[model samples]
Target: MAKGQVFVSMALALLVFMHVGGIRGEMRGGGEEGDRILALPGQPKVSFQQFSGYVTVNKVVGRALFYWLTEAVHDPLSKPLVVWLNGGPGCSSVAYGASEEIGPFRINKTASGLYLNKFPWNTEANLLFLETPAGVGFSYTNRSSDLFDTGDRRTAKDSLQFLIQWMDRFPRYKTREVYLTGESYAGHYVPQLAKEIVTYNAISKHPIYLKGFMVGNAVTDNYYDNLGTVTYWWSHAMISDRTYRQLINICDFSRLKESNECESLYSYAMDQEFGNIDQYNIYAPPCNNSDGRTNGCTRHTIRLPHRPHPIFRQMSGYDPCTEKYAEIFYNRPDVQKAMHANTTKIPYKWTACNEVLNRNWNDTDVSILPIYRDLIAAGLRIWVFSGDVDSVVPVTATRYSLAQLKLSTKIPWYPWYVKKQVGGWTEVYEGLTFATVRGAGHEVPLFKPRATLQLFRSFLSGQPLPTKS
Candidate 1:
């Protein structure tokens, strides 16, 4: 009734309006409040911040990419952002990258609890794991056909779009120094995405500050890769010398089609010569369970090489059945809800790699060496690492591919040390660096967590892998 009372009420109303207006503004810019994860089921207490959610790359088709961000253990705001992708071409980065390798947590054997990865990469950088393309992991598209037609070009474009929109959501990272890293098919995805980012920065008003990229046991040049692989089989005594010769002579990787002899020899090498060992990590015990299905949603009596297909399971080393655990863990309703995944209640269960997308993948660059050259010339820091014991994409294959680069060596080959022991070897070229984890398998981190952590620390700091004990 009084003039003073009326004035006070209007002031309070204005303050409330301002507060709501600010919150709305944050949401429009892709505020991360909604995405911030409180905790995960059975997860151990952690000091760092975590966030996960979907970033829609294609609104028209309703295609969304899923990402999980694990902030640095300390001073997260000061750490650079590193995006980790796992290459299935159809695999879920969440399953491989986040749940096992480099991520903050590791799923237990029973899929009932989580344990901290002693060497989590987030210690040095804000690690972001992304399940790329529409069909992988929790990432999905409303348009059913999108799954069938996914390929390199579209995946890169969508990823760039995701980053752009993701930056809008987590604006602090918009201009932060960023790096791309992955393994297996991600060998293709990482470089392709880097090229996309470099190209995009040229024209976009908001540019992603891509500093460098690193891939482990990556699928690089096909010819060299095939050549190196056969050589590795022979050198490691996995295949007979006779089979090795046949592979070298008969398998023409450059050809678009395979000859019958090549097919037979390859099959013979795998079926008979290679034995029942884990191809991803030759020395490690293979998951002898014959019932592991390709979909990996359920267990049955089946002989499995364990892990995933050669193209996607880059990081299987010690645990032969780690992927099965990932399957059991991720498929939990509580886990899905905590991560804000599978909100649509998709008809199919979450699998590590989508066979349909991998099979139907339309286009693949025969060789990523050209893109490597471009990125190298553009002065981006590039590091290619391989695990020596990986039969699928062995160290020898990576060595052969880098030799083709023909860059003069900066730091000659030398053993890099970790904990007073030889961890691996490294050589720096003018534009790129190549390293090998001496006794590791397909995925270096999974086999040699400490060694890989040193490698990553050196990479982020632009330092050489330690030459001293």
Candidate 2:
């Protein structure tokens, strides 16, 4: 053949090879194969493949859960799968965990774009984020009744179903080591889901392998959480002695909203503690232009502008309005299409937390300590890390809950180092482990990404956090 013809043939062969081996559009899991995102709108170009779509957990309830999965930066097949859930009992993992915390891309300032995260959790392992239960973010149900009535058991079981079906789609992961972790109310969700997986595995011949689980700044025990929260407020000089006294004397976390005194006192305390401050990050700066808005992004204590898409948003200096940016990004029609989300076109806009589910959230247990004990006994790796500055589910509460366990220390408490600095303190026990993120708040990875990543690396490796940098 002529040289020109040979060159053309070679080029065609290269194109075919790249199409087959290329990283951009390969579908890994089989189910909902059409769900593969060819490319996200405005997403920075990268080689890794990402999948986002809904997994129907219950057809009767018309319940479907939304998920976003990013394979490990390298050798995803070799890396263990780490499933992350964000607590709120009503929050979206995709919103808080994926967009704002440790996901690969941070929502750009324009809300119509994305930016690469310098410290994405996907670098260490496959990151799977699910917007669980129903009526939370992109996850929803056709039955309005289910939307308003979400509880721990339903949430856990649904999460399990989602996972089992997800494994079916990605059959290769059926036996892959799975580690469950979550924060906030997920303190309850992760343990409960792990428990369900264990129960399911007891009957199934091929079980979803469970190596360990983790919860960060979680609501493990209600009484302790409340107690720690009040103490945190007062200790941080956020509340007065009188308000603290009221919290001490009258507040019961189990029915925190029922008692007029408890509700009123806590409201007053929050007013004092949260005035112009980020409730999620007490010292973080308030939004510059969005501040003082009456009814936008206020639940997360964020101030958002009236613009359809705020152009003044920033991706730098830890912007307080990141959640607003995320809301805008996730709600965009093109972005949704690229993500394969909002399949049914839910009536309402996507928000960080589901108020309907939050209002009706049925917390069965005051504490998850008993579940932690049981998992520990089962020889599952259990690690609990707390961002010390989180007043919502204060480290004090976490310590108090673990103290109730009375597990002997396998490794005496010591500061874990990261980059030659004290990242946090860690304690290894006979059954479980606990650590503190030195200056982080409710969202550990958001405030201390590097340190949290290091903590994560240690947990995944089943090794103790470093004592020296």
lDDT of each: 0.78, 0.74
Question: Which residue pairs collide in model 2, if any?
Answer: none
Report the number of the highest-lDDT candidate.
1
Candidate 1 Cα misplacement greater than 4 A, ranges = 1-30, 290-319, 344-347
For candidate 1, write residues 251-279 as lDDT tens digits: 89775456787877777777677766667
Candidate 2 structure quality by residue, lDDT tens digits, 286-352: 4555454522133222110001112122225566567888888877767766787643343336677
Angstrom error of the Cα, residue 83, model 2: value is 0.8
